[model samples]
Target: MKAFVLDRYGKGRSLRSADVPTPELRDDEVLVQVHAAGVNLLDSKIRDGEFKLILPHRLPIVLGHDVAGEVVKVGSRVRQFKLGDQVYARPDDLRIGTFAEFVSVKEASLAHKPKALTMEEAASIPLVALTAWQALVEKANLKKGQKVFIQAGSGGVGTFAIQLAKHLGATVATTTSTANVSLVKSLGADVVIDYKTQDFEDVLRDYDVVLNSQDTKTLEKSLRVLKRGGKLISISGPPDPEFGKEIGAPGFVKLVLRLLSSGIRRKAKSRGVTFSFLFMKANGRQLREITPLFDAGVIRPVVDRVFPFESTNDALAYVEKGRAKGKVVIKVR
Candidate 1:
């Protein structure tokens, strides 16, 4: 199998192409022939050693996360899917390797691809869509008629989140550059602020939820836009103690998280708002639930570009630019 292997973690380092043996499938896993893979900022962050404490991935690892492919073989305990089944998934953290020609994915974290989408489109959904699902649906429990502000509305997660929030009947507001206002509005954002021209904190207020995916300054401003008792969920984060406990970090790591998030927690408490960090996990069940929306055209993927498999590093570079309108994909077949 051909793979782009990361030999070491560092800033601005590229993955090396290499021939590696196919992953051995487990009792609850399936071997997928990768057709397309989604590139995410998380991949870059991991490659740069930013998530060492929380994730602790082994060295010389394969880094792709979201995959859309066909099942070539299924493990003994994998009853939900069979040979040739079209699937998409954000594979479990320890098992991710979709940058390769074939990768093994746990059955519990794999979902059938929506028939309405192509492999590249399907590949783009799992990571960003699941992030939106986990943040808005699972954590916030966002309901109809409420107002929510989602930051970086033109980015991968933001584009998906705007559509999901609208589907849930929430009044969605988002911040993006002036050029992307119409794009976010097309995705059902009711209030699209041009961040380059205006401050979101000054314009948006009394929101039920805020999805923060920016720097500490942006996160702080997002907190002010939420009404009392509202939820402020950050994906780009200073991981909080609750998240530290969720990941079951060592005592030292927990203390680090506590110190990193202490100021925001205190400020949120004083304002009667709740603050927490969200790191999305792979969930086939949630992906299955989201499939119907895609099939029905209620939610659609926004793919900015599809790079050839050989240009996987270029795709990562494009996403790292922080200007992609939506998800970037690598056609890996």
Candidate 2:
């Protein structure tokens, strides 16, 4: 099997294409012949060792998270799929490479690809879409008619967050550069603000939820815009211990999380709003639940660019620019 292997973490490191042994399937796993993989900032972070403390990985790791592929083999306990079944998954951790010709994924983390989408488009949906679904629907329990603000409406998670928030019937407001205002609006954002020219804190008030995917300063400002007792769900993160516990963070990770979130939690409490950091978990069940919306045409993928598999490095660089309007994809098959 050919894979994009990372020799070490650094600047301007390109994936070295090489022959690697196929991953042995676990009892609850599936071996997938990857058709396409989605590139995200997390891919970049993993490559650069940005998450070393929280999610450690060994060297020469194959790096990719989101995958859309076909099942080539199924593990003994994997009854939901068989050979030739089309599936997509956000790999449990950075260790299982989706940037390869084939990868092994836990059956519980894989979902049937939406029938309406192509392999490339399906690959783009898993991580970002699941992030939005978990943050808005599962964590916040956002209700229709509630005002919700999503920052960076044009980026990977923002694109999905805006659509999912609207699908849940929330009045969605979001911020992007002027160029992407129309893009976010088309995705069902009721109000789109140009972050460069306008301050969202000044223009919007009393939101039920704020999906924060921006920087520290922007995240702090998001708290002020929410109504009292409102929630701010940050995916970019200052990982809170409570949030870590909710997601089953390890003991050492929880200690680190408590220290990291202590300051932010105090500040949020002073503002009379609640703060929770969101780390999206891979769950086939949740993906199955949301696949109906995509198939029904209520949700659509917004792809900004598709890079050839050979240009996986370039794809990461593009996402690192922080200017992508939606998802960035790599055609792997």
Candidate 3:
């Protein structure tokens, strides 16, 4: 099967096209014949060796997180799905390799694709949507009539978080540039700040939760907007000690993470708020719940671009530019 392979970790290095053996299926896994794959900043960060500590991969690997395709084969232990099932997933961190003709995904991490969506659209949903669900619903336990500020409201996670927050009955405030103000508002953002002109800290205050997906500087600024006991979840991090424990980091890596996040953790403590990092994982059950919302028209997929499989590198490059209004996808079939 043809797939893009990363030979070494480096910034600005393009994936090399090659014919590699199809992923070996496990008893609890399904082999998906990839029709489409999603491009994420996570892909780029892994390529640049940014996540070496927490998500170390074997050398000469395939890198992709989001996948939508048909199940060509399923393992004996797979009960809910079979051959010819249309499915989508953000495969487990160690199992990801959807930028290929075929990638094997664990049955627990896979869910049926929404019938209303195209493969490209389905491909765009898993990683970013899961991030939003995990951060707001699972971590923050956001409630109705509460206020939440979601930074970078037009980016991959932002577009989805805004809608999900609104669905959960929270007042949603988001930050984006002038070109994307209307887009975020249309996604049900109650307040939209033009980051190019207005500072979000000045305009947002006393929020119940904040979904931070920006740099260290922006992450720090988000603290002031939250009310006492508010939840501050950073997807882009200075990762905290809790996250290190979750991923079960090495002793040295744990120490490094503790030191790196000490300043922000102390700041959050002083402000009477809690800080945590979110690195979303795959969950078939969560995707099953989310599919109904899309089917019911409560949440919609926001796809900004679709590139051919041959242009997978271009797709990754496009996402790295930080200009996409939503998700970027690579059509593999």
Candidate 4:
């Protein structure tokens, strides 16, 4: 199997092409022959060792999570899929190696790819789509007629969040550069603010929820845009502890998150709003629900670019540019 291996975390230079053995299938796993992979900002953060405290990986790791591929073999205990099934997942960690020709993933994480999309399009959905789904529907419990603002609306998570919010009958507002205002609007955002020229906080008010994917300052301001008793869900760092516990973070990490968000939580409480941090978990169940939306044309992927399998590193670099209109994908077949 061919893979891009990273022995040590540092700059993008660590990514290198090499031949590696195909991963052995676990009794509860499936061996997927990679067809396409999605490159995400989380991949960049992992490569730079930003997540070392929470997710420590073994050395000489393969760094990709969002994958779309055909199942060549299934584990003895796996029942959901079989050989030749087309599946997709954002494997829980970097070691699964979606960058390779083949990778093994737990059955709980793999979902049947939506029939309406190609492998490249299917690959782009798992991580970002799941993040949006969990934050809006699961955590925020968004309901019809509620108003929600999704920051960075043209980015991967934001694009999906806007679409899903609209599908749930929420009035969605989003922030993006002037260039992406039309794109976000097309994705069902009722209001699109040119982030470069206008401050979202100044123009919007009384939201049911705010999906924060930007820096600490932006996350702080998001609270002001929500109504009393409204929720602010942040996917970016400065994590919240109770939220960490909800996602099953372990002892030490849970304590660290509490300390990280103590001040922010207090501030939010003073304003009569709630704050939660989201780190999306891999779930085949949620993916199953999302597939019908894709199949029905209610939600569609927005692909910014595609790179050949051998150029996987280039795809990662492209995503790092912070200007992609949507997700970047690696065509691994």
Q: How many residue pairs clash in each candidate?
A: 0, 0, 0, 0
Give the Å shift of residue 147 in candidate 1: 0.3
Q: After superposition, how far is residue 163 of candidate 1 from its true place, in Å?
A: 0.2
Q: How accurate is candidate 2 locally (lDDT)?
A: 0.90
* lDDT at 168, model 4: 97
Q: Is candidate 1 or candidate 4 better by TM-score?
A: 1
Off by over 4 Å in 3: none
Model 2 TM-score is 0.97
Number of the top candidate by lDDT?
A: 1
Candidate 4 global CA lDDT score: 0.90
Scanning candidate 4 in windows of ten residues, the lowest lDDT window is 240-249
Superior by lDDT: candidate 1 or candidate 2: 1
For each candidate, give its TM-score against the true structure.
0.99, 0.97, 0.99, 0.97
lDDT of 2 by residue, 1-333 (tens): 988899898866888989999988899999999999999898887788777777768888999999999999999999999999999999897446998999999999999999999999999999998999999998899998999999899998998888898888999999999898889989999988998899999999999999998888998889889899999999998988876677577898899899988887898999899999988888899999888888999989989899999988889899999989899999988
> Which tens-of-lDDT digit does each residue in 1-113 have in candidate 3?
99999999999899999999999989999999999999999999999999888988998999999999999998989999988999999999988899999999999899999
Q: What's the distance in Å from true for residue 244, model 4?
A: 4.4
Q: Write the per-residue lDDT of candidate 4 for residues 43-89, one digit (tens) a residue.
A: 88888988887776887888887999999999899999989999999
Candidate 4 lDDT for residue 165: 94
Candidate 1, residues 136-253, lDDT tens digits: the string is 9999999999999999999999999999999999999999998998999999999988988899878988999999999999988888898999999999999999998998999999
Cand. 4 TM to true fold: 0.97
